[model samples]
Target: SLEVPFPSSREAVIALRSLSPDREPRKGGISKQLTVSGSTLSWSADEARILRVSVNSFLDHLSLVLETMEMFGSPVSQ
Candidate 1:
């Protein structure tokens, strides 16, 4: 089980939704279970390599999304 905390609940929910689709085990015997509560994301997976790959992919997508959000989500209050 892996638990990750996001800066905000909104972001945590977004990450949960984003990573939820891959919950089913793939043909390679890889499975993931994900859930979110408040500002935390909980994930469980089988197979080390598959877990690593899946996590890397998710992180990549997350990085892109965060970058986009920072760029366009809202104007900074000065």
Candidate 2:
């Protein structure tokens, strides 16, 4: 399990939703899970080469989400 902390719970939830859609392309032999509690995103996966690739891809998407959040402010408009 890996826990990634966000500045706010809202951001954590946003990240969770953004990252949740892309399920692993293959079935069986590999698994990935993502969830958010408070201001932290929790991730777990099966240990394998695919895990590294999946995590690297997730990190890439995560960075983009965080950067967009930084630039545009909160996702919710007042």
Model number with the top lDDT = 2
lDDT, each prediction: 0.70, 0.81
Give the per-residue lDDT of model 2 (tens digit) for 4-71. 99988888998899888876656665376788989999887766555577677778888998898999
User: Runs in model 1 with CA error above 4 Å?
Assistant: 22-30, 74-78
Assess every candidate by TM-score: 0.61, 0.80
Please give the lDDT score for candidate 1.
0.70
Q: Which candidate is the best by TM-score?
A: 2
Please give, for residues 1-78, the per-residue lDDT of candidate 1 as tens digits: 668787887877776776566556577564676778888887777656656766766777667766776777743444
Off by over 4 Å in 2: 48-50
RMSD (Cα, Å) for all candidates, in order, is 4.8, 2.3
In model 1, the worst 10-residue window by lDDT is: 69-78
